[model samples]
Target: MNHVLENPVYSALRTGDSHLAFGTERIKYFNEEVSPYVGFAHDDANGFADLYELLPEGRRVLYAKPIPAVIPQGWQLQHEIKGLQFVYEGSKNIEGDFSNIVSLADEHVDEMIELVKLTKPGPFGKRTIDFGYYHGIFDKGKLVAMTGQRLHAENYTELSAVCTHPDHLGKGYASALMQHQLQIILNHGQHPFLHVRDDNDRAIAVYERLGFKVSRPMNFYFMKRL
Candidate 1:
C-alpha cells in the first residue's frame, strides 16, 4: 500500500496544516506568503489542471512527490530538484546541549529571513514562522543557526530550515538544533521527517547520525501558472 509520506504535502494540508490551506479540496496549497508548495489529493495528473485553474497567472508553486510527476501543459516549469526524504526511527529522544538555543518569536522573523538568505536552507518567508516551534542559536545576540517545524502530517512533523551560518560551521550548531527538534517532536508523540537535496552530503550524514533513515527519493518541481 502507498504511504502518507508519498504525498506528504497533500497529507499535511488535509490533516495537520489544514488551517493554513486554501484551494479546491482536490488541489490545495499553502498561503503564497507562507510557502510556495502545492499538493493534490490523488495521484491523477489532471489535478495539475485543477491547480492551474485555481491559481492566477505567474503564480509560482512547488510540487514534490516520492516519484516523478508528468507535467501537464499550461504550466511553465522553472526547474527541478532531486531530493531525498528521511524519517526519524530512533527509539529514544535525542540529547543535546541546548544552552545556546533560544525560541524565536515574531521579533526574530527579520533575522530569520536574513539568516535564511545567507544560508539558503530552502524556501522561507515572513509568515513561515507561523508553523511554530522555531528555535535558534545566538552569538552575542545575533541569530546564527536555527531549525523549525513544517509540513506536519498527522503523526509526523517535518524538521525544516536546518541551517547554520557559514562562519559558525563545524561547531555542531546544526546537529544540536536538530537534536533539540527531534526531542521535542518525539516527546509529543510525533515522528520527525525532512527532505534534503540529494547532493547535500553533509546534511544527509548529520541526519543519519541522528537516526533518520532514508525513506525515499523525491522529485521537486518548481513552476508557475502560465
Candidate 2:
C-alpha cells in the first residue's frame, strides 16, 4: 500500500483544504465561540512552529501529540506514539443487526453528552459532539456502541467517536456501526478517515483486515496546559 494510505493523518493533512500543516488537518467548525483550531499534530514540525508562533507570549499552547514513530529533533517526547489508520469504502454494507440511536432535535444534546462520556471523555470528545451528527448502538434499549462523523473539509468527512461498551465488545458492534456511518458519508460523495493510537495493534489489525490501510505516521503533541 502507498505511504499515505498507511498513515491516515498524512492523508488528512494532504487532502484537507480549510487549514494546512505538516502532518495534520483542520476540521473547521461553524461556531465562532470555540477556538478555530481543534486537532493538532503529535509530531508536526511545521505545525508546531506555527502554533507556537501564534500563541500569545508567556501563554502556553497545551495539546497532545500522537507520534507514529520516533521523536523528531527539537521535540520532547511526552508519550508513546499510537497507530493511525485509514479506511475507505465505496459503498457501505452494514451486516448483522444493530439499532440506530437517533438524537431528535430535543434529545440530541443530552444524547451527545452521554455518548461522549461513554466514549473518550476529554476536550476532543467535547469538541466532536459540539459539531453534532452522532449515532449510537442500542442494546435492550440502552446505548452501546456508537459511530459518528465530524471535521468536514470539502469532499472529506471524518468518521469518529467509534466506541463500544466494554461489556459489549467482541460482538462486531463497532465494525457494523462504522460501516453504516461510512456508507452514509460515501452517499454524500465524501471520503472517510480517522485516527488511532499506533500501539493499538489489535485495533490496527482489525482495520487492516477490514480494508483500512496504514496511511502514514502522525504525531499527537500533548503540551502542558497553562
Candidate 3:
C-alpha cells in the first residue's frame, strides 16, 4: 500500500458513509454496505471474493489482488491496508471557542473544494459532507482550516480530513477542529480513530501532541481487470 493509494482509501472511508460508498457499486460484508466502487462488483470474501461474485456472469474479476502488507496488526488480514489511530477515550474536553465553526452547504461546495486543494489534505469534494459533518474556520470571511469525520463501524468512527490552509498554518485551527470532532464522537458514544501516512512526520507529530497514538500502519491495493 503506497502512501498515495492508502491515503485516499482511508480518506474516502473517513469522509464517507459508514458502509463506504465509492462511485456507485456497494459492498456488503456480513450483510452491511461496507464499501462501494464505480466499476466493481459486490461480493463477500476475504480478499477479492466479493468483487468476483458481483461481476456480471462470465465476466472475470479484473482488479482482484491483495492489499499492501504494511497495515496495522489488528486489521492486517482484512485485505484493506488502511488501519486505525486511536485517541485516548477518557479525555474529551475541548479547550476553545467553537462558535465560529461553520457548516458547509450546497452553495459552499466550490469553496470547500478550493480549500481542500489549497490544503492538500486528502480526497474531498462536494459529496464528502454527505457522509459526515464538516466544520471550518473562517478568518474575516475566508475559510482557513477544517476537519470532519468518516467511516462508521459498530462502536467506532474515524476522525479525518483535518487540514489547515498554508497561510493560516500554526494558528491552532487544526487542534481546535480536532478537539471539536473528538467531542462530537464522544457524544455519540463512539471512539475516534484516524490514519496517516508513515512519512507524514509533521502531521504525525501534531496528532501525537494532541494525544493520538499510532495503533498500526495499514496498506491499500488497486485491482484492475487482467
Candidate 4:
C-alpha cells in the first residue's frame, strides 16, 4: 500500500479532513467556498468522472500528484505547474514571538480574503480559514502578511497560503508568519511540508533557509470546464 505521505491531499480528504469533503467517499473534493482542490481514492477512470460531475461547470480547480497522461473527460487541462515539495528537516526548536500574530477567525474572514486577493496565494476562499490555524500580522490594524495550514494527512500537514501584501515586502513579515505556523504544526507533533512553484526561487530560498529540503518534484494540474 502506498503511504499517505505520497498523496497527502487525497489522503487528507479521505481521512483527517473528511468533514470538509464533498462527493462520494471514493472521490471527494473540498467545497467551492473553501478550496478548488480535489482528491480521489485512486486513478480509476470512474473516480475522475465523478469529480467532473461534482464540480461546477466552469470553475477551475487544482490537483497535484503523479497523475497519468490519460486525461479525464469533461475536464480540460488549463496548465501544468511545475513545483517542488519541501519537508522541514531541521529541529522543531525554531522560535519566534507570536504576540501580534492573531488567530484569523470569522470576523477576520473579509480581511483575509482581501489580503489573499492582493497577494495571490493559491486557492483561498472564505472558509479556507477553517482548515487549520492561520496566523496573521497586522500593521496599524491592517492585515499585511499571513501563513497557515492547508492539507492534513495523519501526522503530516501541508503549509500553504503563505503570502504578504506587496507593500509589506522586504520586511520579513511572511517569514515571521511562516515560523509561527511551522512551530505550531511542530508543537502538535505533525511534520510540516509545503509546495512552491519551481520558478519561485526567492520563496524556495526562504524555505530552504528555514530548513525545508526538497522532497520531490510536483506537477499541479489546473483544470477547468471543457
Candidate 5:
C-alpha cells in the first residue's frame, strides 16, 4: 500500500476533503476552478482509467507521480514536471507577528488571482480560494502577498500558493504569510508539506529557513485527452 502522503491530492479528496473532490470512487480531482490536481485511488491501471473517464477532452491535470508507461485510452501526455516535496519537520512554527495577516474570503479572489498572475507562484484560478484558511497582507489597500492550503491527506495538509507581488518582495511578506499558514496546519495537529520546482532555489532556501526539509523528489504530469 502506498503512503497517504505520497499521493496527497487524491488521498485528500477521498478522505479529509471529500466535499471538494470529484470523480469516481477510484479516482478524484479538484474542479478546474479550485485546482488542476488529479489523484488516483491506487497508482495502478485501474486508477488511470478512472481519471480518463472523469476529465473532459483537452483538460489538463497534475498527477502526483511521474508519467506512467501505460497511457490510458483517450488521454495524451502534455508534459511532465520534476518537482521536489518539502516537509516541515518542526513541531511548531517560530513566533512571528502574523498580526497584519487577514483572513481572505470570496471578495478577495480577484486580488488573489491578480497577485498570482504577477508572481507566477503556480497554477491558480478564480475559485481556488474555496480551499480555505488563506491569509494575506494588504498594504495601501492592495493585496500584495498571500499563502493558503491545498492538498489535504489525513495527517498532512499542503501549504500552497505562497507568493508575493514583485514590488512586495524583500519586505518579509512571503515569510510572514508562510508562518501564518504553517502555524494553522500545526495547530490542527497536522504537518504541512509543499512542492516546488527543482529550479526554484530562492523559494527553497526560504522554506529551509522556516524548518522545512526536502523529503523526496516527486513528479507532476499534465495530461490532455487525445
Candidate 6:
C-alpha cells in the first residue's frame, strides 16, 4: 500500500481539505480559482478518461505522483516538473520573531496574486488563500515575502507558495516566514512536508536545515483535456 502522502491531493481532498474539493468519489479536484491540482483515488485508465470528460476542453490540471504516468489519448501534455518530497524530521518546535508577520485574508488576495505572479512560486490562484494560515511580511506596506499551507493528508500538511520578492532577497525573509509556518503546523500536531524542484539546491539546503528530509522523488504533470 502506498503512503497517504504519496498521493496527497486525493488524500487531502478526501480528508482535511474535503470542504474545498469537487468531482466524483474516484477523482477529485480543487476549484480552479483555488488550485489546479486534481487527483485520483487510484491510478487507472478509466480514471483518466473520467477526468477528460469531467473537465471541459482545454482545461489544464496538475497531477503529481511518485513517478511519471503515461498520458493517455485525449489529453495534451504541457509540462513535466521533476521534484523531491520532504518531510519534517525535527521534533523541536521552531520559534521565530513574527512581529512583522501578518496573517493573510481575503482582502489580501490581490497582493498575494501579484506576488505569486512576480515570484512564480508555483500555480497560486485567487482563492489559494482559502487554504488558510497564509502569512506574509510587508515593507512600507508592500507585500514582500510569504508562505502558506496547501495539501493536508491526515497528519501531514504541505508547506507551499514560499517566496520572497526580488527586491528583498538577502534579508532572510524566506527563512523567517518558513519558520513561522513551521511553528504553526508543528503546534497543530501535524507533520509538515513540502515539494521543491530537485535542482533547487539553495532551497533544499534551507529545508534540510529546517529539519526536513528528502522522503521521495516526485513528479508533477500539467495536462489539458482535449
Quantify all predictions' global Cα lDDT against the true fold.
0.90, 0.52, 0.56, 0.82, 0.83, 0.90
lDDT of 1: 0.90
lDDT of 5: 0.83
Model 4, span 1-226: residue lDDT tens: 2267567788899877888988886887887788878877555658677777776788787777754345578889988778888888877897877788888888988998998888776778889988979888999999988888989887888899898989889988878888888888999999988998889988998999888998877778888856
lDDT per residue for candidate 3 within 1-226, as digits (tens), equals: 2222233333333333425443223442211122222222212233344444444433211121124432221221322324344444347765668887887666666777798788766556556665567788889888788888755544566776788888988778888898888888888887677766556777887788877876545543323322
TM-score of 5: 0.92
Candidate 3 ranges with C-alpha deviation above 4 Å: 1-26, 29-49, 52-84, 222-226
Pick the winner on lDDT between candidates 1 and 4: 1
Instruction: Write down the RMSD of candidate 6 (Cα, Å).
Output: 1.4
* Candidate 1 backbone collisions, by pair: none
* Model 3, C-alpha of 204: deviation from truth (Å): 1.2
Q: What is candidate 1's CA lDDT for residue 31? A: 89
Clashes of 1: 0
The predicted structure with the larger TM-score, 2 or 3, is 3
| lDDT tens per residue, model 1, 126-205 | 99998889999999989999999999998889999999999999999999999899889989989889999999999999
Clashing pairs in 6: none
Segments of candidate 4 deviating more than 4 angstroms: 67-70
TM-score, cand. 2 vs. native: 0.63
Q: In candidate 6, what are the lDDT values of residues 25-80, reduced to their tens digit?
A: 88889988899999886556598888887898988899898987888799899999
Residue 155 error for model 2, in Å? 2.4
> Global CA lDDT of candidate 6, please?
0.90
Once superposed on the true structure, which residue ranges of model 1 sit more than 4 Å away at CA? none
Angstrom error of the Cα, residue 139, model 1: value is: 0.6
* Global fold similarity of model 1 (TM-score): 0.96
Q: Is candidate 2 or candidate 4 better by TM-score?
A: 4
lDDT of candidate 4 at residue 226, scale 0 to 100: 62
